[model samples]
Target: MEFTVKNVEETMAIAYKLGKFANSGDIICLNGDLGTGKTHFVKGLAKGLEIKEHITSPTFNIVNEYDGRIKLYHFDVYRVNDPDEIEAIGFDEYIFGEGVTVIEWSNYIKELIPKEHISVEIIKIPNKNLNYRKIILNYFGEKYNYIKEIFI
Candidate 1:
C-alpha cells in the first residue's frame, strides 16, 4: 500500500496498525533512506505491542531486544559489511526465534532471511515535504498467508 504521511504522527499510526496485526515469529524487513521515519514507525509498533521502553535505531548496537506482549527483536544492519557478520552475531536466533523481528537495512542480509516474511519498503518523495512511503507486504509461504490477509 502507498501512503502519504504528512508528519511523524501519521507514520506512527501506520506502524500501530501493522503492530496490532503482528504475531510472534513474524519478520518485517524495512527498506528506506536516511531520515525517512523508520524509527518513528518502530516506536509506534512498540507502543502497539504494549512495550513501555524507548525505541531507537540499533545502528551501532546492531540489535535491540524489547519485551512486550511478545518479544521484539529489532535489528539494524547499517554497519554490517558482510552477511556473515549477521551470522557471527547469531541472527538466526532472533530471526527464527519466538519473537517479532523488525530489520532495518535488511536488504544487506537478504540471503539470511526466511522466505516467509513481510517486506515493507518506505520511499521518501523529494517534493511537497510529505513522507511518501510505499509499503509492500510480500508473503512467501503458507504460514504467512494470515498476515497477508490481515493487510489486505
Candidate 2:
C-alpha cells in the first residue's frame, strides 16, 4: 500500500502502528535516501515495542539491540561493503531469533533479506516541501498482511 505524510510526525505515527504488529522473527526492510527519516521511523518502532532505550542510527555499529515488549534488532547496512560482512556479524542469528528486526539501507543487503519480509520504501517528493515523504509498504506474506489495517 502507499501512504503520504506531510511531516516527520506522521511518518513516525505510521511506523509506530506497523511496529505494534511486530512479532518474533519479523523482518522489516527499509529503503530510502539520506535524510529520509528512516531512523526516526525506527525510533517510533522502538516506542511501539515499549522500548525505553534511546534510538540512534546504527550506521557505524551495523546493529543495535534494544530490550522492549520484544527484543528489537535494528540494523543499518549502509556501510556494509558486502553480504559476507553481515554473515561475519551473525546476521542470521538476529533475523531467525526472537526479535523484530528492521534493516535500514536494506538495498545494500538485498540478497540477505528473507523472502517473507515487509518492505517499506520512502521517497521525498521533489520541490514539494522538505518534510514531505511518500511511503510505500509491501508485504510478502499473510503474517504481515494485516499491515493494511494498521499502516494507515
Candidate 3:
C-alpha cells in the first residue's frame, strides 16, 4: 500500500498501526534515505510492541535487542561491509528466532531478506514547505498476504 504523510507524527501513527500485528518471527525491512524518518517510524513500532525504553538507531552496534511484550531485534546495516559480519552476532538466529526484527538500510544486504518479510520504503518528497514523505509498504509470501489485505 502507498501512503503520503504530511508530518512525522502521521508517519509514526501509520507505523504504529501496522506494528499492532508485529509478532514473533516477523521481519520488517525499512528502506529510506537520511532524515527521511525511518528511525521515527521504528520508534513508533517499538511503542506499538509495548517497549518502554527509548528506541534509537542501532547504527554503531549493528543490532539492538529489546524486551517487550515480544522481543525486538533492531538492526542498522549502514556500517556493515558484508552480510556475514552479522553472523558473528547471530544474524540467522535473530531473524529466525522468536522476535520481531526491523532492519534499516536493508538494501545493502538484500540477499539476507526472507521471502516472507514485510518491506517499508520511505521516500522524501522535495518540496520547500511540506517535507512530506511517501511511505510504501509491501509484504511478500503467503504469510503476509493477510497483512497486505488489511493495510490496503
Candidate 4:
C-alpha cells in the first residue's frame, strides 16, 4: 500500500496504525534516505506498542531493545560494514524471537532478511513541501498480507 503524508505527524500516525496491530515475531524492514523520518516512524510505533521510554536510532550500538505490550527490537544497520556484522550480534535470535523487530536502512542487509517480512519505504517528494513524504508499504508473505488491509 502507498500513502502520502503532509508532515511528520501524519507520517508517524500511519506507522502508529501499523504498530497497533503488530504481533510477536513480526519483522518490519524500513528503507529510506537520511532525514526521511525513519526514526520518527519508529517512535510512533513504539508508542502504539505502549512503550513508555523514548525512542532513538541505534546507529552506534546497532540495536536498541524496548519493553512494551510486545517487546520491540529496533535495529539500525546504516553504519554496518558487512551483513556479518549483524550476524555477529546474534541477529537471528532477535528476528526469530518472541518480539517485533524493526530494521532501519534494511536494504543494507537485504540478503540477511527473511523472505516473509513487512517492508516500508519512505521517499521525499522533490519540489513538494519539504516535510512531505511518500510512504510505501509492502508485505512479503501470507502472514503479513493482513497488514495491507489496515491502510485500506
Instruction: Tell me the TM-score of each prediction against the true structure.
Output: 0.90, 0.95, 0.96, 0.97
What are the lDDT figures for the candidates, one per model?
0.83, 0.90, 0.90, 0.93
Model 3, span 1-152: residue lDDT tens: 89999998999998887777787999999999999999999988888888888999999999999888888999999999988897778899999999999999999999988888999999999998888999999888777766765576
Q: Candidate 2 residues 31-64, lDDT tens each? A: 9999988999898888889899999999899999
Residues 85-109, model 1: lDDT tens digits? 8899989999899999999988988
What order do candidates take by TM-score, descending?
4, 3, 2, 1
Q: Candidate 4, which segments miss by more than 4 Å at Cα?
A: none
Tell me how far the alpha carbon of residue 94 in candidate 2 is from the true structure, in angstroms, after superposition.
0.4
Per-residue lDDT of candidate 4, residues 57-151 (tens digit): 99999999999999999999999999999999999999999999999999999999999999999999986536788999999888887796787
Error of 2 at 81 (Å): 0.6
Candidate 2 lDDT:
0.90
lDDT of 4: 0.93
Among these predictions, the greatest TM-score belongs to 4
